[model samples]
Target: MKRPHLIVDDEIAVQELVGHWAFRAHTTPIQIFNRATDPFLPGVKTHLFRSLEALDGRGFRNPVLVITRWKIEPSDVDRLEALTNLKLTILVTWSGIDDDRVEPVSSAIAVGSLEVLANSASRVKKILYWRPIISGLNDTNDHFASARRLSEFADATVFTGLFYREEIRAYFREAGVPDLYADVARRKILPRDAERRILSHFEGRPIFRKTSCGVAFAHGVPDFNGHFGIREICDICPEAQHEICGRKHHRPDMEVVRSLARVVSLADLDGIEISDRRIEVSGSSEAQRYFMQHALNFQVHDRAQPHRQHRHGRAEIGWE
Candidate 1:
């Protein structure tokens, strides 16, 4: 959370928005939520099911990412399994953080949901989304062991760090939680050593650095985010997936980038540079950038946020 923000859950508005978004979705390889709450909650599952049912009825074949940390019953599996068109992936978030101020819900809930899905949900893909793995918190050897045991029940596992923004810092400060990062960062606050330890702990497990990479691996496809160009990020990627992504990694022609830029209204087409790994552009919104990235299946970078050599989307806090 960047700031104390007010959220209004307008069901009609969201349904209309999803309809319009799906109406406009023509082969954009991925549709991420882009959801306010945990979709599998009792209060929210109806909407989640209804929306996916509608999308499947419309025969949309793109991958639909369902991010949740709540419970998933066998009925939920049954309903989701009935959907035949869309490639549905449920990303179950678990941090293994003990601090109640940071996370009120127990990670055991996620563990139960993952086990349920692993046993019954064959049509749907499940991922143990081990995240917010801050140092001196959930990055211990025991935490890794717990996550490793949990990972056996998942199609794949993706680990990363926190979005320690100003608002979160203030919240933690008032809650008596220790300061996480040196300061607020636009990118996530995952240190290099933390990442290294996680990699070493997992060894050759189906672990990934990026959510897209995990989803891609689960589906037997290349990363829709095109992370293969950033080879450092793929250091822990499974060997088969490395080859899959490598085969699919091709730089887009400049004319193609220009045409898509025009479509997305990226005015500075001249500033768009086709690099070996990522497409660099001067001015573009996140939505616009993601649209182009999915359309081309390549990484798109904005000039405002320069990616460092080893750090993909992380802050420079601990890397120094």
Candidate 2:
């Protein structure tokens, strides 16, 4: 059987990574379409386009378009509805408008909340969720709970994150709110909790499970401390999982570790590789010091093999 053709929205780095990994594992050609340039690329079966009209000119079949930034409006869905063989996959951070009419052509999944969608295990072909630790205000618990619920409903869960326990925790700490850990721990299993609520929202649904992490930089910039630089100062609490890190300072040469190996979008990978690592180093200077101190203490008792690492190999990085 031919490998499924994956179409990722404009996220050149993610697209590139997915392309490389897909080709290596499933012989799939991961295509990319920048929504900023062309919003209707999903309707085009062949040839890339810079405008939606140009894309509509081609009759595409079962084409999957991954959206990262551009919002899908009613008009956009109308154009997509015109395509008979197109399949739309929207990878968004939060649920905004509804596109129920375009249900067949488009399906929306949160980057951190795939588990919520996975409850419909039958309808979903594959699931991709990443980011184990969501470091935000207390409200983020809802997001995590939703994701976990979706995972419960998936046929097979493919959970992928940068690092399992340590890195996730570290990321939270660097974000200036380590309390999120305690929050997730407190409400992980509660039905009313965010994770459980997400599952409940789509229970008994037929959906495949696929999860991934380490794409925080694709959408935004990082701080000086290699943490999400964006500030969440609302009463709603922080959904740290969707926050971007390391935009303030662009570190052309830095190394990131990919603990798990999987095919990702090339655009996603490039975003990580090219993001301002220096910002992380700088923004979290104080946090890094504290982390190092804690790491020293943990090292005395922790014994896990270092799994993966990605290096940019440059110095003099800065943070925003």
Candidate 3:
């Protein structure tokens, strides 16, 4: 039996992890769609529906859809059902809204409002919601009823404390709302230890905490047998410099990153050999170019090798 296929449309890093996992599972074509112009677009939904329908019609029964915090409308749901003729599994970041005080009906109602078209045709199975007790937002009583309602209606519930609070706060600060951090810092939703446990559960491995740019980050345990590090594109093509790196240097494209993340996660779970053939990097673009040329000089060097030892630490990858 081959491993199931996962389609991920989130961050590049996440796609990489999922791809790594898929490769280990003996799944073919661990693909990533990071280039999706607008995941929520009606056109994208039609594209997915058509693609999934074609695959299912062609006997690809083992398929799974993995989305990260992307909202779906009701019309999209209807189209998906019409195409695939199967229930869809959805993963959502419940932390975006207050889950403690809102009733399930309220949450469902909110979703229904947003998904009027899709909701009319499809149903949601295995909804994983992560709830974190924010410091100042610890008053669960405010939203507990609604959350419980949603949980009861959900097929499967995976609860986690708020793991992205610091990241969210950092984003706000960078967007010129640093003071919002103060308010968030005062919440008492999920304690640091509990948050660690929640992350470990989904990752199925140990979790490490790191601080970067005044934000707290969590790194999942390395999937040693899966792709674990960034594949700096510069290492493979010295002249492929792009503006993405803010310099005349090449950087790993979004699709590559997503593919690696998926493969790593699947590999970690199934215990398979992780591909280490990724680009190497130095401190700066100039340094990276130098290293790329140096690596290419070796007669046996393929420019891409399984440099497993140089994988990114958790904070750098931002799984937390």
Candidate 4:
């Protein structure tokens, strides 16, 4: 029932999409235009310009998250800075993986982008998105050192795992690339050992377990996802961010929760559960759940799929 309209054509279509979505009071373009190819700039891939051009001047203070490892010039930063209304955060993805087969784009490109965004673009926030740290590939001490050095360039850093799905495994097999993980996972595969190594390496840094944490930290705002409720997830958060989130954290009223549940048209309102950690609802689409979540600035979970304790958004592959 998730009818997401894909706007891939002209500017008019983009404008129409933005116009329709602009009315929402809290629209976090959280995960969008990950690797958009820039039509104007050759050898550059970024949906940043076209998408942001449409979003700019819309008078929306929505948080926009654009994750990319592509080319982003200083000129592009200027264009991004011009957009004064939107709270934009660019997460430059760099894992230091040198394997041409696994990652076609060099890590240097993303490193350069991070540095540029950090040195320039005063208003626009940046996060050193250190991710997809595969074992024996980019998980070396050198990699960590390089990423640690790069972390200083951004407002914050978030280390995450690889999306080693069945399809990805198949592709790797076809390409004669060795299996990245012992088995594929529903979530990104960040093993316990790898996580420990990362934590140890990134000790005493502005790091986060979640992307929203880094994004919110960069923008100096509370986590719209309301992750502070999950104590384990917030354990890695900086004291300043933790305080900021704590100040804004409040258990939402049941009436408001009921209102959100109704917006999703849940046939049984009795099934809705709202704890400090998250709002749990059954029989709702992803779009409906996310709508309520972004609107309430709280975590919303489907009762059918319960998240594990202390391992909020992580894959069970490593923990087990």
Candidate 5:
């Protein structure tokens, strides 16, 4: 089994990515804590915390691939770094050249968090810079400035193409950022020229471009061992860099299935069959189908397991 992917953010999409990777890696499901309602699967090696504050009281022994946003403070990072066993990767998104011009969602305070991580004693393994392309707003010369600034700190940068969503459209209008928001109000994909122009800014920088979530930035982690959904484009996924899927078969470990079965039963799911490395749920309700599908695809750790209970001292405990 490989190191478990530890996701520390609240983004459902990112949580799902790590969960998918856990199944593909044939390891325990990604342990996630978004500071919200508890995630499914409470008996296996997977875990979901009520909040980021809960982690201060817990410890992990395995070399976990820690994926988190740059929202944590230096003090929090210091404590996390104290756990020498875990590997850390910080993800941050920016739109403007600096904090002052960026959106409140990507503000100076948020950028300060990145700086805090960089200065912290934790020695973060990787820093992935994310730039969500927004036309006229961040797609101008300002994009180059942001990319250049990113090169100063990040190991790699991922440029995510913007998509049209009602919330996003409404956000730009409500935020009072003109032109750019209106430009993207109806459009989804960033124009080819705009993408090229933004990308060109990082031409000579150490931080190169790969359009994706931060996963493509991982250096030691195997790409095939994980999964990316529609975001699994060649330029973004490191697995595509080596062609792991074509060369090797990625079969789910039966133990993972068995572990997930416990979650299935707990979810009150019936008509679920596990065989031949495949899970089939017959004549199930929509909620049951959703439960079973997510359970199988993600980590299913038992938070109530005595061994995984909170420990304050240096005695590192395994999530398993």
Candidate 6:
């Protein structure tokens, strides 16, 4: 029985999207925001609540991995801490250093939320998410400045390449918002120079790279999710890496990976030590499918095994 991962997103849709990924990973996906559902995999129990208050009513017996955004207040941290059975992880997605650069990523809430969360005495882990590194737009030296300044506030910084999806572009078009995807004509890979530029911003701070932004600090299949477990590309944030990321039961499935590596096109495995069960896999949707498929196969064999897995060390992907 893997520890249940509690998904806490204000948007039920986002929770469901990521929750389904966790579900496919064989990790328990517990919803913190209540929403009506259609049907999920059989024998999988689905838990939903109208609010955190509703969840609180049902006391947690096992230690839970509580996942939420950094746009939260210290009081929210306090409330989470009160749930002694829960371990907290907050993912911060805003990279605007100051007010001038804040507009694009700003929610209805104000910027500088990370600072407030940092100053609190609570033990929640913070992850700086510099995702969607839009080329020529938000990808600049200012990115480094913002990351350097906020790096102290977070437990680790995870940077990901920007890829455009048709559904998202269609939504932006329908919503009348300028699509950033149009800037690059919907390129799939994050520009290598842009990735380096963002990595440069984390000088003296712990940093890790992944295929998708915001994948760190959450529970799922790392290889499939496009999170290769090595900080070799960027300097590791020492202080932040030490913070507990609440993933104790999840471990990588080396045998499955070795088998998959032989059959699949893992271009990034060069010079990597797979015998240790650690390899740098290129971030691709096909790889994720392989990982997810392995996990599904386990369910057929024995639901208890739950299939494949992957994780990190200090400079590693930063999973607990």
The number of clashing residue pairs in each candidate reads 0, 83, 58, 2, 7, 6
**Candidate 3: what lDDT?**
0.34
Worst 10 residues of 1 by lDDT: 1-10
State model 2's lDDT: 0.29
Q: After superposing candidate 3, which stretches have Cα over 4 Å from the reference?
A: 1-38, 68-75, 82-87, 96-110, 113-128, 131-133, 161-169, 176-320
The best candidate by lDDT is: 1
How big is the positional error of residue 186 in model 3, measured in Å on the Cα after superposition?
21
* Clashing pairs for predicted structure model 6, backbone only: 144-201, 155-240, 206-236, 206-237, 224-288, 252-309
- lDDT per residue (tens digit) for residues 2-46 in model 6: 334444543464345445533432233233321232111121123
By TM-score, rank the candidates, best first.
1, 4, 6, 5, 3, 2
- Compare candidates 1 and 2 on lDDT and give the better one: 1
TM-score of 3: 0.39
The digit string of per-residue lDDT tens for model 4 on 34-126 reads: 434323234322444656666665576778887777778888888888887888888888888887888877889888888888778799999
Selected candidate, larger lDDT, 3 vs 6: 6
Instruction: Name model 6 segments beyond 4 Å from true.
Output: 1-71, 95-110, 171-188, 211-320
Per-residue lDDT over 11-93 for candidate 3, one digit per residue giving the tens place of the 0 to 100 score: 44433543552222212322223244423444454445555555445444222343333456655566555544322344333
Global fold similarity of model 6 (TM-score)? 0.51
Go through the candidates in order and give each one's C-alpha lDDT. Answer: 0.84, 0.29, 0.34, 0.79, 0.42, 0.42
Query: What would the TM-score be for candidate 5 when compared with the true structure?
Result: 0.50
Decide which is better by TM-score, 2 or 4.
Answer: 4
Query: Which number leads on TM-score?
Result: 1
On lDDT, who's better, 2 or 6? Answer: 6
Worst 10 residues of 3 by lDDT: 210-219
Candidates 2 and 5: which is better by lDDT? 5
lDDT of 5 at 200: 70
